[model samples]
Target: MTDVIVGAALVRAGKLLAQQRAWPERHAGQWELPGGRVEPGESEEDALARECREELDVAVSVGGRVGADVPLGPAKVLRIYAAGLVSPGDEPRAVEHSAVRWLGLDDLDDLDWLPADRVLLPAVRTLLAGSFSSLSTAQDGL
Candidate 1:
């Protein structure tokens, strides 16, 4: 099975970073979270970091796993994770994305996402819920 690494970067008060692919890229012109396949010999975390850097020119701080291993189509195992920007100023340079936006979780439904991500949405939602558990806990403290 094809092993793919996907990142969910949270930024700016809960907005999640999303990207529109550039032409010639897989799922070109569609919006999805930024990440790519794990290169041979690279760990998933390292591959994620490399993919983000190569595709967006922005550095990211890898975070906890928000998604479970998922099968996409007939031969793909997608590993999605929750991540954050290394710094708030690290806007995407979009090397492979034609456009990039920081989206709120509620807004994710509006985008035309890549097929793998589309199939992975239920898990993404559950993952985001897990990620937000901390926020809810903090808010309860407030």
Candidate 2:
């Protein structure tokens, strides 16, 4: 059976959470959405939530599925899902990542996203607008 990997796109107030890789030197410093492979008997949404809790130390509400599946390897496919924090004040602490940042629309394309994840940027942009709104909203305190 094929292995399914889930990626989380958590947006808040015009910003999307992005995580930088820390290990396997080759992919280190490059950004990828926070998630991991789903284990046997685990649902995809559950896997995503578990991944966030393990990697970021936060709880997230998994929303709609995002863009097309991204090829991670011969056996893995990376699929992203839209998410929001269960609590606004619960900031994600990057326990497994080198760093974490909240990225706005203008800042999306500039980051060196992992090859598998870059394909989802367009969908991510759309998701961000719905959940976080615009730059003006961020300024107006929405």
Candidate 3:
């Protein structure tokens, strides 16, 4: 089985959490969904939760995956899952990066996103759209 790189498409109030890279000059300043590689003995969910805690210092609940698995290398693939903050009062920070930004669908295209992360933008857009698509039905007046 190939190793998987997991990411969290954490959206709240119509915005998705994006973490900016601060290391490895090559990728510095690029944004990516918060996550990392799944360890040998860890399940995808566990890995995501662990990554979030380690990288963002916040807990999250993983939901259905956002996009199809993307090839990272011959033996590794990148996968992302929809997620929400477990502690609503707690905000994610750039524990390992330079910054964290919450972006709405309209602003998605403007970021200098990490190569792998940019691939999931379409799916992320779809997810964010659906998240706040609720419309009230008031046929009979209140």
* Candidate 1 regions with alpha-carbon error over 4 angstroms: 9-12, 126-142
Give the C-alpha miss distance for residue 50 in model 1, angstroms. 0.6
RMSD of 2: 2.5
Cα lDDT tens digits, model 1, 32-140, are: 7788888888888888888888888877878777656767656667777777778867677778778888766798899988776776677666656655776678888
Candidate 3: global Cα-lDDT? Answer: 0.90
Q: What does the lDDT read for residue 142 in candidate 2?
A: 50
Error of 1 at 103 (Å): 0.9
The lDDT-based order of candidates, best leading, equals: 3, 2, 1
Candidate 2: where is the Cα deviation over 4 Å?
134-142
Can you write out model 2's per-residue Cα lDDT over 59-116, one digit (the tens) per residue? 9999989998888778878899988899989999889999999998889988899888
Q: Of models 1 and 3, which has the larger TM-score?
A: 3
Q: Better model by lDDT, 1 or 2?
A: 2
**Clashing pairs in model 2?**
none
Is candidate 1 or 2 superior in TM-score?
2
Worst 10 residues of 1 by lDDT: 5-14
